[model samples]
Target: MTYFNKDIETLPIDKLRKLQNERLQHQVQMIYNTVPFYKQQFDERGLKPSDIRTVHDLHKLPFTKKDALRENYPFGLFTVPVSDTVRLHCSSGTTGKPIVVGYTKKDIDIFSEVIARSLTAAGCQKGMKMQNAYGYGLFTGGLGLHYGAEKLEMTVIPISGGGTEKQIMLLQDFQSEAICCTPSYALTIAEMIEKKGIDLKSLNLKYAVLGAEPWTESVRAEVEAKLGVTATNIYGLSEIIGPGVSQEDFEEKGTGSYVWEDHFYPEIVDKDTGEPVPEGQTGVLVFTTLTKEAMPMMRYWTNDIASLYYDKSAKRTHVKMGPILGRSDEMLIIRGVNLFHTQVEAVLEHSTDFSSNYQLVVKREGTMDSVEVNIEINPELYKGLLKETSLEDVLQHEKIQQAHKMLTKKIKDEIGLSMKVNLASPGIIPRSEGGKLSRILDLRSK
Candidate 1:
């Protein structure tokens, strides 16, 4: 299938910038004229729509934050009339208040196109059958990929998440070509595939578009090895437009996600200063939807820290954003050192004995902060270690010490912090009853 707007997707760098500038100018005027929130914000800043002539001038526009959407509640920054809004979705708000987003029919169409483009970039073809395991309903993952799969004329099995047994059954019976879901769920499914002893070669599955949660290369390798599929990352936020912001092409290794700039203008800026960061430097990711009709933000701070670089190989002039490092709020300050959950996960992943199911607990001990990594070791390995030697207790204790030493060194290297590590049995580590992993258990006092 060919893109409806090929020029924008394949435009040269200079031409793409010109198109973005033109769209930015028009959207600024449109929002200023119709949206009360933009009007008030611009009026307070003493800025006119004419001031935003180029995409670089977007720095002058106020940045929209999650609190702004919460303060507005519903339908606050919508550019089009409420009557024109055809659909709406709200964020899960795992962190804070849920932000509601409205979408006109045009906006929905653009969203579908962007998602389809992302699928195509990941090498999804028309004749292939896909099993969409992303959750539906209030969450955007399911419906976003569902619509895009249909748009691509791929026969879709709308298997909305959960029910691992049924999902695997259909995956095998239907000979599915691709699956779309979060990286965590993908790993879970892969584990199930191994437990069932299913021959992945017999099934038709080839590719997977995994997102919704930040994942590391180690996890991707695990998923690919287990499922026998090429894994690609798909990025989006409900605040912007779900599942279509950017996507990774399988041809590249550790390359940034190629932004769908036709509908959204992407930028990276200094998190503290709100000034544009130099290319290839990590900073806050910001986006402005140029063609969104219902709600088009001028500059929305995504809180995700990543770098952006122009992909010379793609020749599309679209900025590719690096993998999200971690959330700004999720960063922990321990003894004046910055720590992230991913750092802990990376260290744990490097150890074969460490189970993927683990949690990081950051708590205060008197005058200083302390970190404890509670990890679960695979049951088989634990049992084998116990049976094979009289040094079971010694081995376990030494393993914890080894993990602590390795983690301490890695953390010191990454963020200059040394932390304590603790080990537990396979199921000893606390997780959600439903088997969901918890990243943090912060007990810092206010």
Candidate 2:
């Protein structure tokens, strides 16, 4: 219920549109005058800053994609000199070149403010102790959450990420009430608590804001039950000012995440067509930075798949984005069928018997392609089975076999692919050490 900036968050839609229009216009002019990237893109199209007078004219501009960032390298897209940029962050791209982004002091403040708003929405309160597990340095997760938590007036335990043993020790010792980390890492910690037989009363955590990877309702359910907290999603990217572009409200779980539109105006566009889509239709997300001073983005293609709509019954006035279905540019093509891992994740979400943790392994066999899904068995069920039988014999159990068959059939039926589903013993798959977990392994190239 508490808002870091209630005035902007609850601005009337009409007035919000006017503000967005003004900011978008200013951002266009600023970028066109200073950055070669924007100037070149606009000039090539015979466009001028004055041509884009409002958010409605945003479609007239070309999209700034990750390739543009890569082509610009360290500082080409920057509107100001390097000295004016206060801090920098880079994404660990799949290729050799990393996508770098910079922020000015004001940009940093904007980042903190949006994250402050995000934390408040995720059920965090002032004076509450926050154990920030998001990693720091070059990567924006740790410091991003740290500054925001401080702005929110909570006691911040800047523990960073990893050190499973130390994280647990400090959580019990300090009794931090909220945690921030990747969903996979959170699950690893939850599993560790049970496997180590740690006392539940020792932990005082109540809220978790998980992101940097696409997760499902099943993961949320697991984290909530295991950690005894209300887990919500906080979404962002290195290019879009880190983990506060939008956030899911603690009370409104599946409704969507409210985008901080005053700063980041959002539009959903058809991935292939590169045109805006109708409201509620799934497409690639595009954002035009309205207030970023360091490196303002113009219709930056986010690649994230989701639709946006105005949630009439919400605490904020900003448009809400549905849970990211998957990445548009990264969707896998297997045997002529395109799929996102999250689609398979949805199957796991519907099944209460399986663990949310899983990985996709893609391989090519003599002119043919195949997919194998390795999913972790529920820790509680595994632990229970160990009491009666050995780990090897547990797989022979009828319930375990049935669950595996059901999951495989579900994936086939829903995703339209016959993926080989393997139910692994809990803790068999590798977990996130500190950063984002790579969920897919494509061996076709090899």
Candidate 3:
């Protein structure tokens, strides 16, 4: 019911479009005048600043990919002088040169403003305490949420992810009401709470805001039930703005996340043809920053596959985006069946006999690619089985065998592909200490 910025958030459609067009045109002029990359891009297509009069004219622009940022390197894409920008954060450069993002004081403030809107939507309130478990430093999760919480008037823990012991201690001591972290890490914490035999009632956790990786309803239900909180999804990419480009309302969990359109204008385009798709059709999500002062991107392709539509019965006026199924680059084709690991993870969530800890192992058998799913048996289930039989029964146990068969069938039924399933002991699969866990092991490279 509450919004961080109500006036802009609920702005009428016509006025909102007018604002977006004005900002888009200004952004075009600013980038064309300053950044050489955009200058040449415009020149190549003979795109004058006057040509882009509205968001509808966005199709005239070429898409900016992650590689473009890499090709530009550190400061090449920046539209302002070094002295004008206040700070810089960068990707790990794992692929090659790091994609560095600079922020002016105004840019940082806008980042906080949008995140404030996000936290509020995720059931955060003024004076409520939040344990921010996202990483700090160059990574935008920690500090982005931190400043945004401050802006929203909430107390932030600034734990910076990991250290299960300390995180548990402060949750009790601070009586925090909300937590922000990756969904996988939230599951790890839930498992730790079970292993530690902590009293869930003693803690005062009310909400879990999760993102940075694609997750499913199964994960959401598990985290919410285990952590005793309502879990909502928050989406973002570092290129456009760090976390808070959109947020799922706590009340509207499964529906979709509302894109704060006053700042970020969104459009879905066919991945192959690079043409705009009809509304409600799944395609690559693209963004054009409307009011970014330091670095405004035009038609920056996010590569995330999801449909967008206006929810007429929703609380806000902004268009909403469905949960990201998977990134374009992460889609794996095994035996010509296109699938994402999350699709498999969704099936696992339907069964209680399995924990969220699982891995996808991909290998090439001769000329065909094969995927093997290795999921850990729930510790609770394992403990129950131990009381009834010996370790040898794991192979022959009817219930254990049934659960494994059900999981394999679910993958085949839901994901449209048959993957080899290996049910391992509780601790067999690795867990996330703090950061994002690599779920897919592509051994085909070797």
Report, for every candidate in turn, its global Cα lDDT versus the true structure.
Answer: 0.80, 0.89, 0.89
Candidate 2: TM-score? 0.96
TM-score of each: 0.92, 0.96, 0.98
Root-mean-square deviation of each candidate, in angstroms?
Answer: 2.7, 1.5, 1.1
> Which runs of model 1 end up more than 4 angstroms from their true locations?
1-6, 94-97, 378-380, 389-408, 413-415, 428-437
How many backbone clashes does every candidate have?
0, 0, 0
lDDT of 2 by residue, 1-446 (tens): 67788999999999999998888888888998999888989999999989999889988888888889988998998988989989989885768789888999999999999999999999999999999999988789899999999999999999898998899888899998999999999988988887788877889999999999888887898899889999999999989888999999999998999999999989999888998899999999998899999888888899999999998888888999999988997788889998988888778885656777788999989998888999888777877888989878988778888888888888889889998888888778879886789788888898
Tens-digit lDDT track for model 1 on 1-446?
A: 24434666778888888888888888999989988888999999999999989988887887998888998888878877788888888887876667888988888888889888888877788989999988887778888998888888899999888888898899889999999887777867876777678888877889999888777787777778888889999999998888889988777747878898877888888878989988999888899988887888878999988899987876355789999888786777787877777776665565666667677888888988888777766555666667655644734566556755675677567656766666676656653211224578887764
Residue 397 lDDT (model 3): 78
The lDDT-based order of candidates, best leading, equals 3, 2, 1
lDDT over C-alpha atoms for residue 123 of model 3: 90
Could you give me the TM-score of model 1 versus the true structure?
0.92
Candidate 2 regions exceeding 4 Å error are 350-352, 386-390
Error of 3 at 427 (Å): 2.1
